[model samples]
Target: MTIKKFQGRTESEASEKAKKELGENCVIMNVKEIKPKGFLSAFKSSTFEVTAAVEEKEKSFDPSTAFKNMPKAKSVNVVANEKIEIPSFNTSPVKDRVITPAEPKADSAISMFSRTKEKEEKELEQKISNLQSRIDDEIIKKEIEAEDKAEEQKSSENRQPTKLKRKNENFEFIKTLYEVLIENEVDEKYVNQIMDEMEKVNWGGNNVDTILSAVYQKMILKFGQPKGIDISKKPSIVFFIGPTGVGKTTTIAKIASKYKIEKGKKVAFLAADTYRIAAAEQLRTYANILDSPMKIVYSPEELNGAIDEVKGYDLVLVDTAGLSHKNETQRADVKNLIDSVDEKYNKAVYLVISATTKYKDLLEITDTYKEISDYNLVFTKLDETSCYGNLLNIKLHTGAALSYVTTGQNVPDDIEVFDTQKIVKQLLGGR
Candidate 1:
């Protein structure tokens, strides 16, 4: 590195001057403007009175060892008539003699003191420059990091939500049946065929769960369920996604209650849906009833950390926001929540649907959620429905399987294991 000062020239011109003498790689650390020459010198502008003086920082930055790749300096002074007045500046020129660490003696003390003073001043200047460079580097790095974060957030915001809109509610019957088909572990494609059939029928007001369970069993007997990831040996962590105010927190509570009490599994709830004021409170309300540990994760980073900390539990349920089925961006946002934690730890995702919803609305709901759904469909409010044909219809549209069939708003009594034949008989008003 070199400090090349070219008077009456732009920075680029100063660079060229330094390069002509010190080769192309010679770094221009700084530049300074010199005073104009005497009265006659000022008038003769074209003759060039001001001279560009470049000094090599040899001892301070030795090419031989400082940087292994530095080219060997093979420079010669050019013959220029302009007398360069050595500017008496704050910094000492490198031409000053090296300060040696000689032992203090009566004869050399005075001289040593002078050298020590000079050395201290030079060292102080060097320290300041080094610190400045380090600070500049840190600022640059921080700026780059901030820009990257902003870009990522912007990209996330630009994405549309994943839920599809339910148009005219025509496919409701099929959607209901599709939910059941998925629960029975039927193949996704066959379940979809059922949806196609149910769509042709286009009838409204079928019971979501019962019909779904029936068609699901039929599809499984005929086609077979989608290959579900085995979570028996591993940890059982689940995430629930669906439209808003559809009993997401309640369903989570039901699952936790059933597992902890009936199945005798250790359960914990991690409340990831911090968006709503009552969301976490509602989950807490359930947690209090089940007497299982409930934790809230305010950030994605926190969510990941909590999952790591809450190991050794039999079941962990992460609850998400009740985003509109019509909003697509909500998919990615929900995905971030899923990704923030370990969804791979998740063996199952439960799509909770209200059994009271109409058949066409049910179809639209399932279709809207089809893109991101791989979990089983858990239907709630089954007691509210007389017609269970919608369940059959849901099995036809979305290929999700049934995990549990929720009947009422009751905590323990309203939820049940998805039994195909029993549900069909019950739906038809048979014993």
Candidate 2:
């Protein structure tokens, strides 16, 4: 038996050379970079690390007889054998794990060869090292064991699909909207009736604005008209509350504009939307447009103080924060603010709604906001929507009377005193 080493310009080249020298069956056992042998090696020289490896020959032969029976293939070249006696092999140690020897008579010869090969420490190390290199688990450097690696590989190959996080988040969002609507006690009649109307459209997803708009529409349609504004009532402090960006500020401007010019009534505005700088700026701009007085109120105490001070004015509008009904903490805080104002002055609560919000969201927004606002309805953004059904729906369901309808951002031009027929015409797809 003999072990041989081969090298070439590259690993593939070495592999080819090994195959040419030994046979295609030759397996690589070990590979390493050897220092280049020429003057050019000094600058940046490199050589292909290679291993031309084979399990040495081990077979018994009636030396002369085996040679006579050898195949006459062009790949094989055999010389007539002189005399040689092959030995019997003991294979008990590696019985379970070893690969089958190439030939039956070679079995005994292979055992003897392996024993002799093991005795040479450097050669044995090289063969074992080559075997280890071919094992194909590059991650062993991280201290991961073979069993864990095999398990990880298996798991990766057969991964299972789970629900998408985005879809889960959307479902959760929709669920929350419904919860807020329920919390508002938005009249079970209104919810069922709005759902019936919404069934006409597709509620297949969780679109918050669209859902909120629909609910708001239902409430307005059912109960939006001013059952009665008591002109005789004292210190009418109208507090507007609902979801953020539903046009609370704009609605306040509309109401203030109407009274200041149309009725020739004195109007003063208290801006409590100081949560955002831009929000305050927006109201201030409205104040400038209408040429009305606007006071920035940070708390309900300031609000009452403003109410006390604006006693000569015929109407006082308090602009509250645009709150999310889904946020309980914020909703409760708003509730406290509304209670504070009412504790001192007579609070005329108005729920400002947008026509673009969804039915479910409207229910939630209504339910969440009604805790702070409970007098009547003021709808905004009429010109931006095609669905008037929600307005009809909310009014018919919520039992809150309509106070005003806002068509656009124009202070005087965009607003309309609650006209049920005009709104109904618009709801029915009229111009």
Which of the numbered candidates is closest to the native, going by highest lDDT?
2
Residue ranges of candidate 1 with Cα displaced over 4 Å: 1-231, 426-431
Q: lDDT of each model, Cα atoms only?
A: 0.62, 0.64
What tens-digit string does per-residue lDDT give for candidate 1 at 65-162?
33343333233121222121221222432432222224335236534544665577578768877886787678779889999999998877664221
Tens digit of per-residue lDDT, candidate 2, span 34-86? 77543234676566655555555545435454544444444222111211223
- Residue 337 miss distance in model 1 (angstroms): 1.4
Angstrom error of the Cα, residue 316, model 2: value is: 0.9
For residue 17, model 2's alpha carbon misses the true position, in angstroms, by: 99
